[model samples]
Target: MRVLLTNDDGIQATGLHAMRRALLERVPGIELAVIAPDSNRSASARSITTRQPLAVDEVRFADGERGFATDGTPVDCVRFAVLGLVGEPPELIVSGINHGSNLGDDVTYSGTVAAAFEGALLGIPAIAVSQQAEHGRTDFRPRGRGWAYEDFAAGARFVAELVAAIDGLPLGERTVLNVNVPAGEVRGVRVCRLGRRIYRDELKLESVAPNGRKHYRIYGAEPGYHEEPGTDFEAVADSMIAVTPLGFDLNHERALAELGRVDLQAAFARSIERQELAHEG
Candidate 1:
């Protein structure tokens, strides 16, 4: 099977490299194509480059394999492959073994998740995988100085096995399987729903320069999650892998019905009548 692997952590990232090695070694007869950002594009979401043409570079990865690096967002990389830029389109797209967990509302702002969303939109089954850091280790970079592929081996191998059985997985049209592996040993895998995040962002003024430009800090604070059962956050807290099926359809059927009960047409007609009366006056 031909699979396209991409990530928001750039080509040289440990997570990306781990995924490469796992897929090649575990998935038998799997042809892999790597296309990722030249630098970290985390939280870039589904944005695409429209102002200028994207530039692509051919480079050798840590595993001595050639891959493409682009000055584009994660979604752009997916577009390039679907547009026949990476030879024939791939049958599946696997995005990430991300440096950090993409849980709850975080998926909306995640470039890793966005790449999978793009693949699913183009009729290809996709998976977005991430690994949470160990307790007190906020930095999710490679272990020590050298590239520690084994740190991400478990999650990477799981994804490789997932790809082998993807045909049997219940992947709906325009849907993505979002996976998040906990730090340390993975106890088990749980299919759960997206959880809620409790943000504690504070706005602080760092400095005001001579040019009257003020430098402030609004983000970078640690976020908390609601202790809800059967959520992705809860699954990971129990040292389990969380797999949430995300669909492209954003329609809220209950809200639609509630809004339909409102007489919006009557309100428009009343506004028109008022305008006509004022014009006549």
Candidate 2:
């Protein structure tokens, strides 16, 4: 099977490289190609380059596995690859093994999740894996020490096995699996729903220069799940892998049903009559 790997953490990110190695070990007989951002695109979400053209560069992983590094968002990388950037559309797209977990409402602002969304839109099965960075989960070994992927090696391997095992499972249309693995040794994997991520955010003004240009910082809050049952945050809190199926459709079924009860034929007819009268006058 052919697989396309991309991430929001850039081409040289440890998570991306670790995924490549783990997939090679577990998912046998699979062709792999990597296309990701040239730099960190943490919360870029689904933003794509439109004002200007994108740039691509050929890069090699630590093991010499070559890939493409693009100056675009995570979604841009997926669009380019699936739309024939890396030869033809790959059968599957595995995003991330990201540097941090994408849980609950955090998924909305996550480029890691956005890449998977793009894949799902292109009719491909996609999985996004993330390792928890907070709650003492991340391993920070100085600056440029180059051991970022070591801590989450096991999680990356698990993701690869999952991809092979769940190849033919029914995931519905325009759906992607968002997997969040807790740091350290994992206990088990659980299917769960998204949870709320709360934070105390405040706008901070840094300084004003002589030119009257003011600088401000938008600080992002951390994930604080209320330990809700059957939620992705709950699974991660318990040291288990959280797997949530995310879909692109945002239609509110409950609202649609409620609106069904309201009769609008007369309202529509009156609005049409008003328009016709205005035109006649």
Tell me the whole-model lDDT of each prediction, alpha carbons only. Answer: 0.89, 0.84
In terms of TM-score, the best-performing candidate is 1
Give model 2's TM-score versus the native structure: 0.88
Off by over 4 Å in 1: 136-147, 273-281
What would the TM-scores of all predictions be?
0.93, 0.88
lDDT of 2 by residue, 1-281 (tens): 88999999889888888899898889979889889999999889889999999999999766767999999999999888877878878888899878878888878888999999998988888999888875443221113334466767878888888878866677898899999888766899999999886755668898999999999877743335555799988888788988899998999999999989987888899999999999999
Candidate 2's displacement at residue 141, Å, is: 16
lDDT of 1 by residue, 1-281 (tens): 98999999998888998999999999988989999999999889999999999999998865588999999999999998888887999999999989888889889999999999999989999999988866333223334344367768889989999999999997889999999888887888999999998877899999999999999999767788888999999998888889999999989999999999999999999999999999999
For model 2, the superposed segments whose C-alpha errors exceed 4 Å read 136-147, 261-281
Native-referenced Cα lDDT, model 2? 0.84
